[model samples]
Target: MSAPTPSARVTLAELAAEAGVSLSTISKVLNGRTDVSRTTRAKVEVLLDEHGYQRRGTRTPKSRLLELVFHELESAWALEIIRGVENVASENGLSVVLTESGTRHAPGPEWVEGVIARQPAGVVLVFADLPQDCRRQLESRSIPFAIIDPAGDPAPDVPSVGSANWAGGMMATRHLIDLGHTRIAAITGPADVMCSLARIDGYRTALNAAGLPFDRQLIRYGNFHVDGGRDNALELLRQPNRPTAIFAGSDIQALGVLDAARQLGISVPGDLSIVGYDDLQVARWSSPALTTVHQPLIEMAEEAARMVLMLREGEEPNNLRLDLATSLVVRQSTGPAPDAVRPLAAVG
Candidate 1:
């Protein structure tokens, strides 16, 4: 917001003060985001000449900001991740800037380029990916990054934090098997997602361990969101031999599965037991309460923040990826499989 100062260095806050504009307006101008009004943009441009506000790609020693980007912020679990990052950041006198990339967890090259230009102390990416070129750009600029629960496979050298997804998946399936569920199904996230595949492997391993034949038809690959769960559940439940138990990849999807069962008048626990991953808050609010895997998402977020901070201090973590513990949290949603059920046509 401040006037032009080609040779001077002024913080964004100072520029905003001089231009009498909000910090966001100044940022939009700085990032060339194009959402700002022409009138405000013109005013800000005029002030840019007086104050040297364009930090550009300069790695300022005084910059205490950390950029946190999410692919999508609509999930209930997102709040928990935010709180964890904020807690660590606040204690270390670091501020956080939040960015949301469209529907995917990782933004495109354009967004990555903007972040590189911002030159924050470090960046934390959640449920997203960084292209090799983008990763190189950040490294070339001495910017370190950490990914949490990465939605895709990360480079071998990329720092990341997540849970034991395969083990968690195995645990969920084992529980249903222990309840005497021979006909079981698992609705997992996208097949390409690393975590999703790991979870599917866990499920398959558990079934094999129990001496149960692995039926590929019992597996459904879909999005990790709620609607995907419901639609996938409908397909499975309408089949001639629907599963007596179901394992949902996420709490959000599990909730959708619950809805599908209700729509079909299938009494949960009594007729169809359910299990879900991610012990998000909504799991506790489900009609029968969700039996879920505790993925330790908050802890993962906290570890990611710490890792990025350490990187900024020129510290290399001992490991490329940090994995916290994951365990099952049994609740009312899961029970012993029922002895019999009406035909799929009757429910349909």
Candidate 2:
């Protein structure tokens, strides 16, 4: 029945003075910089513990940092998500280091490893397709992480937060159907991505519900980029049985579809109706205006950041499969399917 002795408080300068090193050296050592000698590092470490001094306002063990890995920063989608993440992280007094995976081809493994080695309090994966090697490294280290718009086969242990892409797809298709279009085609992202597959499934689901046959020819694959959409749309238009309406998976692709339609001299909503997903800012500014399925990008990002913070604190997130709803925005680009017209000369 004895009270424990209060530990003495020590500052960085005090530690440096005792260890016979400069304040900068002490700061570098504490921050895990590699410039300090082993003897100096050891001496500083012993004093830090002896004084029971904790670094001001950070997670235990003095590293109050997190890592956020994104697929592409150039995209408005990613930028919105990052804004959400930054807001949450800042509110929580956590420092977040962001890195982009670049285009699908340039996933820098070294950068991921460096982040992992830094031993962040947690990690937020913003729409990046995690490789097996990276997944393995994260798992082995028991790092707390959450995937936003998870593309790979995520382990059950790690949670993910994203909009229900399949539902978004179904909603988009249904909107076209409600507008009196039956011959609807779909331009989708890479087959490897789970979101793309889910979207395809949703499209099929809507078609099946309406008793419409699922035509394989109507489905085209793209890289979720404008050029890919343009190429695929050109092929779709070339077919003898062209669709009256098209549902593009992303806003960027939808822009390409519009370009292709223009090149083919087809009038939007007159010859072809178009709808796109992601409801990005460009959708509003597009020439005929774009009807799109709106995903709550900012909310999704905020939720993912909150999830990472919770995981870092060893808290189980309540909603494992957070399926945010999607809304269909109506615009001038979509209308009733074009009607078959007889030649004026023949009629006369």
Candidate 3:
């Protein structure tokens, strides 16, 4: 028999006949059974794709596991996110399955295959956009997913959780401005990322609102790391008309700014002030505790997990994009700008 039309609900017998396989073999592939040979599975999957096949009555299938995928696990913030998801999982009597897959943008093909095989209740991805094909595969299988997007960029149609990066940036800068700092410099993440751009824009807006002139030379875009902060701070501090305060993209980067100030014999909060973002744990433990913008990472993760679970329950979210509010945490790292400048530290 010829393959059924795309609009028609194709049956296992039709798919098996089209693939020249037994009806049982078709069932195995549909169920993600690994007993089938690789070649046979590929052939079956291609035909299933062409036919828009999906298992009947399996949507919102009963499951007790939630999956959380991360592009990389090296950052300390990962723990906060894990704790958030674990909190939700515990409340719902579900288990969390953590996986490190793909890059910052999208997971690898193998990840989708593994996820399809596992058939999770729902999935939460951190900093990774789901590709269209992978999204289709998951949707066809009736798997719900959400993104915890700290980068502030996600697919328009996807449900995502993020913090108010622009407000965070503005608050950080405003705190410095409130400290009587006129010549303030900002060190943020890479130029291409939306979060970085939003934060910097907030900084500029704050400066303009406070009647402070915006200086292009005072702005530096670097990776969200300690080294990026230190290197950029070094250059900024060396200039004759150096800023008395600096706002960093991340708490880790703030540590580097502290390092750079120490190297230049500049006393933090005495001669210079500093502000950091994310308010990570390290911010509290720094030599001089960081004054920072709290991004509410744990809360954001918790919201994303809740969204995923809601989707699994066949509930539609009122909003596709949820941005949590960011607040400023004042600590010892910032103080009023010095009234009189100290002589420049000697640089070898």
Candidate 4:
């Protein structure tokens, strides 16, 4: 008997015909579209596996293009993260697509839908909250996705990468405490964000550990922007029982706090000490360099991108909760408490 020749590449039409389904139904099942029954999807998936068919444009049977979604392109923080993602994707010979969530006023929902239509290998969400419906759609389709600094409710089992925000918060507050500052205030990011909440918990933990009472009056809410930081700082400074030190959740907010102090004619470390999180380039170049807890943003981005690629290749990534450590960098912005008052008695 003659040896049988292998069939050519399996087409969508062939898979549908073999499965005794319509082409459109097969397409929906293969691409993870809605309105498909679980039984039908399983059957189609099995057929694809049996035939050794490859997705279009993929070099290897498992290779794929990944998409990165960001809300704003102008933010240096976001840009650095994107660079990290690109570096990892390039090194692995994978393709990447970039999409912006549109402007602050008019966030474009269409872009997300468009990415889903294109069916990239996976997705990486940066600093933006994704809708529940979108998440559900992706889950139904079996598209792998990961989030970096996610601000929304994350799905269980989905991988995520972020710095140790709570630890960073604790480090920042502890740095202030070590500088002999007992009356320390905190400026936090949006209340809904997990990072903000984690940082707040850290701040409270540090204060409690030092035998200090957790004073709610010393905490202020900000939008993680410079203007918000400035406003919060001004409000804190106007209070009768003002804090001797301030910890801003982000570098931008720290800058705002510094500006507010300058406007009020208060000398940094002479009368007020300030600490910031996220040691972006601006933190070091400020008039008095910011003492901050540095979160490895680039490394975080790289890890997130790498994980997405691994998922695309059908590899189970060993790392699930990749928690990066944070360290405090002392600088001119912090010093011993001002000579204006005596230290409070330790609680314990």
Candidate 5:
């Protein structure tokens, strides 16, 4: 007798109830999420082989395209990430489709609906705060997703790729402290972002480690952009006791900090020192060449793309959370603290 195909006999819903797990759990077992325990995988595998079941449906699958969505695709930073994704996608014979969320940090309702209509094999979200409904919709359809540098906490079962943000922050801050700069300030990414919050925590931890008090006034939130860095740096510089060194959350912001300092006639690494994050191409070209923490943005993007492809091929990752290492890259923008520049009037 011939065996019954997935569409012919048992459905995933029936198998989920039989196994006493949620639909998502069954989907994870099929698509290969490493978070599922070994015992659970064995149980699901037994049932799958017993029933000769395969995936959610037995129909011919959707197109061989993968979706890459971003909050906003601008800046050299975004371009680097794009290049990584494109490299992997093209090599695997899969086309890439790019989407921008426009005004919001995550895709809107309309965007999600459009994705459902198109039904790509999988998705990669960069700096997106995945909405609960969006997650449910994708899971329901067995459309896998992996996040790159998620803006907020990702779903517990979802795979994600990012650098060691906390370590990067600590390293950047400690470099300044080691340079004998006691008056150090940090301009971090948005307050709501998970990576931003982690980076700030590392900053505070480093200060506390050095027996320095955490000064609330010295901390400011930027939007991971140049303007935000520039404006915030301007404010910090105008204070009566301006910081001798400033750590901007991103390279773009670091350049903006340099701009602000130039406008005030302050010399880089002479009157002031600057440190930035995400050692991008511009970081090397900035007037003084930025000292920064390398965040491995391209590598993370590439990993995310590869994960999506693996999900499409029905392979589980060896690990669910992949974090690349970050290290400090010293350049001309940083030096020993200046002796003469102690206080500031206002730079209007």
Candidate 6:
């Protein structure tokens, strides 16, 4: 069957009649209410889509609130993000509404329903991608959204803010190489994560550019946490020909590496050098200040908030994807390689 013309105006009553449902049922389906039966809701939604139905006059008024959603609040950077979002929200006389939604991939349906009901000014989601259904619901109501993706992976069509993860990795490895460390190892986040792959690629590239050998055995992947760092560092440090320097994926992981070095009676920057990612507060507070990559978490959050606000104002973003630069922060955690250490077996 041919689809209805875009210029044709379709009313809620017409949609209800076409679906053989009550007008309230149509409204419930539109609002994402769970009370309506799936079959009925599906019928109404198909009709709505066919007719290009848009609730022009009935659009919910935007509230004086901005929604900042995270899959979880446990990360060290969560506070930084919150501070940045609040900075923008307060300046614009909008209160920030924080929500911890579903998995890292997307927010749950319940969160979507709450957002549709509240009709916030805009939303900033810390996720890899926004689910299509959620995006449609938000867009249908004229609610704008942006993704703050630290994972170095985002949907191309979506407006997103992320950091230069590959560059950060390259900087960390290059620093160690410049310090005359030939036997270096790296522990990054999960192998499946795009950021992890980008970082490891950076590490390999730096090694290649410096005429150093890339040893697969010297690379490890784990969660971006203290335990992942500690466990992986212990294994790498326990080897007879252990690396003289280690580059960690996250600041939290670097702490774990420090603990491992201490347990093995290895001196920081004396017998072993360490570099970490994310210049978090704890990085400076450690026994030996951590040498790390400075990811602009707060600035990234601010940029995402601004982008959403721009969209709310019916303005298009200059760029759908923005990757902020990363810089290396030198600290006491890294130093030249020890005299006794040498490059891996393949490199003499």
TM accuracy, model 1: 0.79
TM-score per prediction, in order, is 0.79, 0.75, 0.92, 0.78, 0.79, 0.90
Residue 327 error, candidate 4, Å: 1.9
True lDDT of residue 170, candidate 5: 96
Candidate 2 lDDT tens digits, 1-348: 121244555667887888888999877655566677878866776666555544544444555777888767776687787788888878978788888864553347656547645877778886444554455445434466777773444545557777878888899999888877888999998888878899999999999999999999999887889997899988888666788899998989999999988888778988899998898888999989999989888788788888877766668899765767778899889998778521222110
lDDT of each: 0.82, 0.77, 0.88, 0.77, 0.81, 0.88
Error of 4 at 190 (Å): 2.3
Q: After superposition, how far is residue 286 of candidate 5 from its true place, in Å?
A: 0.9
Model 1, range 136-180, lDDT digits (tens) per residue?
A: 556545678899873466766789888898899899999999999
> If ranked by TM-score, best first, what sequence of candidates would result?
3, 6, 1, 5, 4, 2
Full-model lDDT, candidate 4: 0.77
lDDT of 6 by residue, 1-348 (tens): 243565777888988888888989988877777798878866876676566565555545557999999999997989999999999999899999999999989998779878877778899999988876677667656688999999847779889999999999999999999999998999999988999999999999999999999999999999999999999998998787899999999999999999998877788989999999989999999889999999999999999999999988778999999999999999999988888953333210
lDDT of 4 by residue, 215-274 (tens): 999998779889989999988886767789999988899999999888777789788999
Tens digits of per-residue lDDT for model 3, 44-65: 8888777777665766466788
* TM-score-superior candidate, 4 or 6: 6
Clashes of 6: 0
By summed lDDT, which 10 consecutive residues of candidate 3 come out lowest?
1-10
Candidate 6 residue 101 Cα shift, in angstroms, is 1.6
Candidate 6: list runs displaced more than 4 Å: 1-14, 22-25, 28-62, 342-348
* Best candidate according to lDDT: 3
After best superposition, candidate 5 residue 72: deviation in angstroms?
1.5
lDDT (Cα, tens digit) per residue for candidate 5, span 31-146: 55667898886787677666665346542375778888887777556788888888888887778899887444567766675676567878888754576556656654567888
Position 292, candidate 6: lDDT: 95
Q: What's the lDDT for residue 327 in model 2? A: 84
